[model samples]
Target chain A: MGTRDRIVAAADQVINELGLVRATTREIARAAGCSEALLYKHFSRKEDLFLAVLLERMPALTPAVTRLSGQVGFATVAENLEEFARAAIAFYRRSLPLSAGLLAERSLLEGFRAMLAETGGGPHLPIMMLGTYLRDEQKIGRVGADADPDAAAALLMGACFHRAVLAALVDLGPDDKAPGFVATLMAGLGPR
Target chain B: MGTRDRIVAAADQVINELGLVRATTREIARAAGCSEALLYKHFSRKEDLFLAVLLERMPALTPAVTRLSGQVGFATVAENLEEFARAAIAFYRRSLPLSAGLLAERSLLEGFRAMLAETGGGPHLPIMMLGTYLRDEQKIGRVGADADPDAAAALLMGACFHRAVLAALVDLGPDDKAPGFVATLMAGLGPR
Candidate 1:
């Protein structure tokens, strides 16, 4: 593997073990078998490295959500939503620890927010994308006419996100309910 | 206020400002105008003080949820749930920062789990209570027989939790959709 990939892999391991707040860049470099200077040469900051690890090593919902806009009229809405909800729950479980660290400290939260501002990236991205997809479905007369796209998006994503949050806070083994949740929601969201 | 109440209030302020993990007992005692000995006398542990703050200072969903089971056949299901959802959302927003610090460090999380075990207290209590309430409603035929109460409870509380989480992570002012979300879910959960 190349230097960048090696560094990201090392970061993924270190962060998962020590969490995002406690995982030092020095330790990550040592894990990667590289010096701190070399690590800095590849990534501008620790946050950049963390972001790379999240994107490269973790399951991301962005790809699936992006693909959803194209499936507006092809499949049943319930089936499509259940698939998306399942993928989103998995993504959230992986990403929560990485992001939870940002909330633990004030400066870290601000720095992370600033980084997101620079990159035009934040947690709101997925919700916005999902809302747009629902809107597209609405245009095709697949989603109900009076459904609030933004509210529906928030509810769907929020449910998935909460399931991950609960699992992280406590032991919720085999408590997966994404499919049933989607089914119940789709029943309410059926075309008018 | 008495010494115990004073300590609890002071701990609330300190924990809110410095977060739960960083707020030292010394700082809390100083804020309360009491010696560390006096603080320790009043509260055996910092976690106890944090719990007191959560139960005493912050809004709690327990009372609302507890009252819900008694109201099974009284009001419209949608209205009752919307009220509960709003309260849960508000409670989650207040309690999130306090609980989030525990997840940042491994030792803190372990300490918290141990504390919860001793007290038989954890995050699952609300979901269990809500699920029981839903079952009561199902018995009265106010809720559909096919509905999964546990899943419904998780989705309802989870959506509220995620709304708070999202707002904490980003700027989402006036994005409150608890009423509409309840309306949508209730449409699916109506009596068969």
Candidate 2:
């Protein structure tokens, strides 16, 4: 692997273990088997390196969008929603520790925000994407005409996001409600 | 206020401004106009002082429970859920920064976790309480038999929690979806 890749991997590992503050550049360099000076040569500061790590490690949304698009008209709406929920839940679980660390540091948080702004990213984008998918289902008469797509998306994604948060705070097990929950929602959403 | 109360207030203010690591004992004591020794005497450590402030300032659940209990049979289910969502969202908004600060530090996070365990507290207790309320509504033919009360509770609480998390990450504004969101969920949950 390239020096940059190794360094980024090392930083991710160290940060997950020791958190952002204690995941010193020195430890990251040692783990990457490079000199600390070499680490600085590649990335001027820890924050820059952390950003690199995030782009590489944070789950990309493109595949998920494509997957959901394919399911809207082709699959049963419940099956599609369940598949979407699994992907969203897994992404959130991976995202928690990474984001909590960045949000805890104001400087890092500002830098991260700047990047998102430059990329035209908004936090609500995911919810909007999910809403779009629900709208497609609605068009096909799979979802109730009375249901607000955005609110339904929020309800589903919100549950997944919140579950991840609680898991971070304390050990929480799977609720075994995924299948049942989707079934119930679909029952209400199906044509009246 | 008493010396102890004064010290606690100063510590809360400093911690909120400077975060957990930078809120030094001396700084807090100076802000409180008390000797560092007296601060220590009142609270053995900063964590203890933090806990006191949390109890005093954090949004309490008593009022919410009382309000919800009164609404079980009287108000429309939609009204009760909307009212509950408002309270949960407000509490989560207030709690985001405080918990993020503590979670940033491993030692402090462990200390806080230990305290929760000793107090016989679980993160899902509030959700469970909401579930119980829904079950009662189900008994009265308000909620659909198909909707799992626990899952319904998770859905509502999860959205509020997730919204708070996103707001903490970046600037998020009032969604104005609370009322509509509750209405949509109730439509799906109403007897089919």
**Taking chain A by itself, what TM-score does each prediction score?**
0.93, 0.81
* Model 2 lDDT per residue over A43-147, tens place: 996767987776677675546767897787786778888877877777777766666677666666677777666766655688888889888888878777777
Give the per-residue lDDT of model 1 (tens digit) for B63-110.
888778778888887778888999999998888777677676667677
Score every model by TM-score.
0.87, 0.87
Deviation from native of the Cα of residue A125 in model 2, angstroms: 2.4
Where does model 2 exceed 4 Å of error?
Answer: A24-26, A35-48, A58-62, A174-177, A187-192, B24-26, B35-37, B40-42, B45-48, B189-192
For model 1, how does the per-residue alpha-carbon lDDT over A9-119 read when each residue is reduced to its tens digit? 998888778877778889999999999999999998777887787777889787888778878887877777778898999998887777777776666677777788788
True contacts kept of each: 0.40, 0.39
DockQ in order: 0.40, 0.45
Q: Tell me the deviation in Å of residue A36 in model 2.
A: 5.4
DockQ-based class of model 2? acceptable
Candidate number achieving the greatest lDDT relative to the actual structure: 1
- lDDT for model 1, on a 0 to 1 scale? 0.78
**Model 2 Cα shift for residue A44 (angstroms):** 5.5
Q: Which ten residues in a row have the lowest lDDT in candidate 1 chain A?
A: A183-192
